[model samples]
Target: MACLGFNPAKIRNQNLHYSKPSSKIVPSSKPIKIKPSPSQFSFKLHCLKSNSVSEAPLSPTEPQISEQEEEVDDPASELSFLDPEIDPESITEWELDFCSRPILDIRGKKVWELVVCDSTLSLQYTKFFPNNVINSITLNNAIASISDDLGVPLPEKIRYFRSQMQTIITKASKELGIKPIPSKRERYETVYQRHPGFQKGAKPFLTLDNPFPMDLPDNLFGEKWAFVQLPFSAVQEEVATLKRTFTFGASFDVELLGIEIDDKTLIPGLAVATSRAKPLAAWMNGLEVCSIEADTARGCLYLSVGISTRYIYATYKKTPTTTGEAEAWEAAKKACGGLHFLAIQEDLDSDDCVGFWLLLDLPPPPV
Candidate 1:
């Protein structure tokens, strides 16, 4: 019998033939190039595929697998798009071109007429005037009528009135070339009197009392004076310039002793003492009595070292003395009586030296 079984080589060749033929056959239909609409594409690709593909059988026409995915990505497609409500160009036009309406020019008009014509603007205009005149608006029937029509609060309207009066006062003062005097709180406090006295039978050296008597002396000779020296840094050149020129103009003669640094000293005093003196001088306009006679050789460059000192000295010199030098000397002795005395020494340590001594006479009673 002829062998019914096929040859092993032929069978193997036949299996290979079947596989090659299956892969090689060209598909009859061209790929249906149906582009998906955005909504339809999104629904199937995202929602439906995610939900039904896991369990339900896919349609025969649908692609079973994704084609070769792109390796390179487009960066522009990743960015989100935004829409703004306002047009930038329109905004520019509005700012540059728009003028809503015209406002009235009511300069030099009566307050009532101004209030009546434009109640809304009346309060603002009144603020430019003084309170006294503004207060008078209540008596004006036209102003009252406007206030009633506008339903403005009575208190607010009164405030406008007060503001008007204040404006008037300010204007008058400006016109008259008179500076308005500041209220008491704004004014610097004056040194009315300074008296030093020991408690009855107390040791004078242990306790130094400031003997500023309220009673005006008949003569202001040999009165105690204080000198405050100001030391400024080189960085404060502007302040220093102001201090030198405008500070001591004809309005008031200020004695400028000289400038010093933080390290420099007026006399044999602590660096802190000289520093303290600067602020004191600034506050007092450098007023003080001459402690020692002006000596060009001993670092005492000026007669006295402060603007305040200069003013006090000048004032004292201009005022008349009731008692002569002899009586003044006696009074000085009386003032210094019982206090321990130390000789004035320039080279002495700051601790060893006594406090500064000034011969300032009390001013006579005001007539």
Candidate 2:
């Protein structure tokens, strides 16, 4: 699922009102905004299945929104809570920037990236990291299945497959910022997400759940597609990227607060602690992986700076002193790509402690 990237700092202060009685209204010359309760409105989060034929799914060939004109303005718009492709009925403003941003035509492939920007800090990019992967075990399993189907020896195919995997790993490692290819070591680091306290030891995950090069009837080159698997260390692997990592038991909230550098001006900043009564979900790219009170999903550790950039850097100075401190600041690189900032928040009780790296994207200091 894509994150709702509408800048939290821009959310009207009056709209942040929650759990108060109606009589607390403060009259103003400006519009008196009343926040809607969840009981009163629903922002359609997809429909449940029904037996009715009218609720059937659309066929793949069915006419989808034309790429040229993604969203047609609904002439019947009530209040004009306007967005090019956003549903006006959505109580929460959805970021439909992708629908309007120019699509990239790369190698004739229409690459539509989920880009995010904090214009105040001049930081922009999407989290591009590997989540789904077919590892060595999965590759071996695929080879075994394919060889049996094709009446070939698995040994010869394994050698050929290993070579292919090595090639892919070499290229990908450069893009992944893994010093040596993970293909070489049974243990190599990639951005990851997991709870802090699990039984300490190597824990193998995603171990050959489904073999790639699936045995389809028309798939003639199953071996061609099932070339190799990248085996990750089946270890405790407790480390995870702070982009999606959060304090284990702390209930928290996140807000993108525009900071005040002077008496008159405010700059972009993000905060992820206090004023919120409960745990909050962390949004990275389009994925919703962490919650203040719970873990909804996992494996959303990516936070790359650009399309060409690899390696989402979230390593720290120390293992969190307390489990409540999910992130630690070991060192701060002066610059990342064109972005320059300090590790302004870390340790427990800081805004970044709850998983929002708000101050990390600040503009460079005047030289």
The worst-scoring run of ten residues by lDDT in candidate 2 lies at 221-230
Question: Candidate 1 clash total?
Answer: 37
Encode model 2's per-residue lDDT on 1-367: one tens digit a residue: 0111111111112122122221211111222122222111111211122221111234698676442222121111101111224322232111111111111122222222122222121222221112233343433333234325423232210111122235443343334332221110000111011111112243332121111211212211011000000001100011133323542321111112211121111111122223331222222212211111101122111222211122211221221221112211101111111111111122213323232222222221110
* Residue 153 alpha-carbon offset, candidate 1, angstroms: 21
Worst 10 residues of 1 by lDDT: 184-193
Model 2 lDDT on a 0 to 1 scale: 0.20
- Candidate 1, residues 125-219, lDDT tens digits: the string is 11112112333233343233323543432221121111223443334333433332211000001100100110223221112122221322222
lDDT of each: 0.20, 0.20
TM-score on alpha carbons, each prediction: 0.14, 0.16
Please, what's the RMSD in Å of model 1?
A: 46.6
